[model samples]
Target: MYQRLITSRHFVPLLAGFGAMLCITALSSLGSAVQSSVWLMAPFGATMVILFGLPESPLAQPRNIIVGHLLTTAIGLSVATLVGVTPWTLGLAVGLAVSLMMLTNTTHPPAGANPLVVMLAGEHWDFLLMPVAAGAILIVVFGVLYHRVISGKQYPKRWF
Candidate 1:
């Protein structure tokens, strides 16, 4: 099973990575042009890796990517606001995000960093919307379109 998984044609990941990076770059440019407060967040880099490089992962699915980031971002922002951004609070936020994500069945691993991002940046509620939620949704949109245009691969094996 492992060998079969590893033996994919080399170009698959390469092409996917290129396309994903292009999409992300475009998103960043758009965000800059619009002068949005928070256009891109750090975690979305990992998101690109999953969405493009490992499109087969359940974490890469539209539902998981969108919900996981949104849910975790909300939890992280809440924790930061409620508990304040101390060492203990940061730890608590990440733990809560992970646990909540697992319980919700929306476990996108990249989202695990959301708490740290929020706490470290000292961000508030708005952080949940722009860079976290909006960015994630855009990535999903790009993934869906990219897969449609690219032949021989079906993205978002399932929607919800």
Candidate 2:
């Protein structure tokens, strides 16, 4: 199963993009919410952009980033609101968000920690929309530009 999954064309792009983004995230010191949020760093956005944005992947496109992060944030905030922040509760929140993201078909694995981060930090719910979702969108946009410049890969096949 692992081999089969990794052999897909999407795999290489995902890995490459992730590596590039990780490098950028580490070297650059951007103060954006996305940068501030540990959960929204390079590997996460890189994977989403490569896997979903490139070749116009339905799952990796900008919409997916926006929608997926939004959904995950909601799940996390909801869990946090319902139950105060505790180790067990935070774990449950993260697990539930992951399950929900999969069920909803917006499975952005890196986003799995969003709920726990928000819950533990006791941050406002709006943080998801800002640095998280917006950060993701920015990453996808950057990826699109980067791929086009470096490799001539068309992104978002069709802009909505």
Best-performing candidate as measured by lDDT: 1
TM-score (C-alpha) between model 2 and the true structure: 0.64
Please write out the lDDT profile of model 1 over residues 61-139, one tens digit for every residue.
9988999999888887888777788888888888988998899889999999988887788888877878777788888
All models, RMSD in angstroms: 4.0, 6.7
Judge candidate 1 at residue 2 and give its lDDT. 40
For model 2, what is the error of residue 9's alpha carbon versus the real structure, in angstroms, after optimal superposition? 13
The lDDT per prediction is: 0.83, 0.63
Clashes of each: 0, 3
lDDT for each residue of candidate 2 in 58-155, tens digit (9 for 90 to 100): 66666666666777777778877887788888888888877887787776655776776677678677686656766676666766775565444566
Native-to-model Cα distance after best TM-score fit, residue 138 in candidate 2, in Å: 0.7
Report the Cα lDDT for residue 26, model 2.
40
TM-score of each: 0.90, 0.64
The local distance difference test score of model 1 is: 0.83
- Window of ten residues with lowest summed lDDT in model 2: 34-43
